[model samples]
Target: MVEFGALPLFLCVMGLFSESLCFVTLEVEVGDNVTIWCRHELIVSGYIHWFKHTCGSAPLIIGCKQFFGSVPSQNCFFFNESERMVVSVQGENTSLTITAVNVSDTGLYYCSSTDLMRITFHETNYLRVKGSESRRQSESAGF
Candidate 1:
């Protein structure tokens, strides 16, 4: 005999929460390159920036940073010098790539999109130094 109530109960026991959209990795050797990818949205057109808000206050510009010169500098953070970050408004991807990953580069990073009118969608991603390959392999095996 089959039980209908049991199936629903089984599913309830499993934790299902937020939906993941993009595939990104922070794999870089001590002297290698690292890229951070995130799903982008069309709502962000004119203004695009990458902020390393370790505590999620606000976002800031990346390269050629002018510290509240023309960009919105709502929060301050401790950033690394060697970190390479890039945002693509065309590809709907706020992916960042860093060369020569160092211990100082590890922190909580957020990819945010904005327009001159309002801020759009943003997703938080972490930068770690190791085991991304194993994690990817494990996810594949599970399916």
Candidate 2:
């Protein structure tokens, strides 16, 4: 199914990390791993959350797997399942990863520090998923 491409709408929301820069970019196959990045200052500590909001369908909350340590009760899966999501912390850097990419994964993903002191999920990503099998078949058969 195709949906209208709409600009990401920001939910009225930071000094951020004084000198810290946060960025989350994902690259993966249709049914492989999807990684989210959040790199910045080392002297800062903040809770992070990853969310994917489709234009039409309900937004999905990445689960406890990605928590820095423990999952926040209020931030729990109050909306959708977050099991597929996992958190990876390297030193002071924070990032989220998702497995099994799907068409539904196509949408705007947002990342924010639970403290609300930092904001960076401002980018909207439009992912287009095509069947690899279909492509292979077409290639073998030739145009």
Candidate 3:
């Protein structure tokens, strides 16, 4: 007979090495354009979700359901008005593009995908925006 007590432990161990979302940290200057890519290999029906996480605050949903399909069926909805934010998805590749990125856009961004089987994969990328010397100095001076 199979030991049911050890099944949960076995699954937990497997989950640790599950496939992870693929992305990289990005550093760009103000007004620069950048794209973050998220990739998954699972062949299950799923939806992709993007979020921006700021310090000491809840994550803000930047986009969702980024996939290749009809516009209404696979559309990205931005919680805030951001003319710079654009998202595109094709098969296993989902990318978020930011045009003319500003200082306020610097933060941690996450890309998550969940399939019908309830298996989820997610990755976080840190975006750093460089500012002018004056602005940096002012920030350092507590301004």
Local distance difference test, each candidate: 0.46, 0.48, 0.65
Q: Please give the TM-score that candidate 2 achieves against the real structure.
A: 0.50
| Model 1: residues with Cα > 4 Å off, grouped in runs | 1-28, 55-60, 63-83, 88-90, 130-143
TM-scores for every predicted model: 0.48, 0.50, 0.66
Please list all clashing residue pairs in model 1, or write none if there are none: 34-98, 36-96
RMSD of each: 12.0, 10.0, 8.0
- Model 3: per-residue lDDT, tens digit, 18-62? 223223568898889999887754354556777787666777878
The best candidate in terms of lDDT = 3
Report the alpha-carbon TM-score of model 3 versus the true structure.
Answer: 0.66
Candidate 1 lDDT by residue in tens digits, 44-71: 2344456553323343445221122233
Task: Write candidate 2's Cα lDDT for 1-143 as tens digits.
Answer: 11121112233112232211322334445787766665433234344555666555566656422233333323344434466766655654556667777655655565544433444343333344445754675589995
2 or 3, which is superior by lDDT? 3
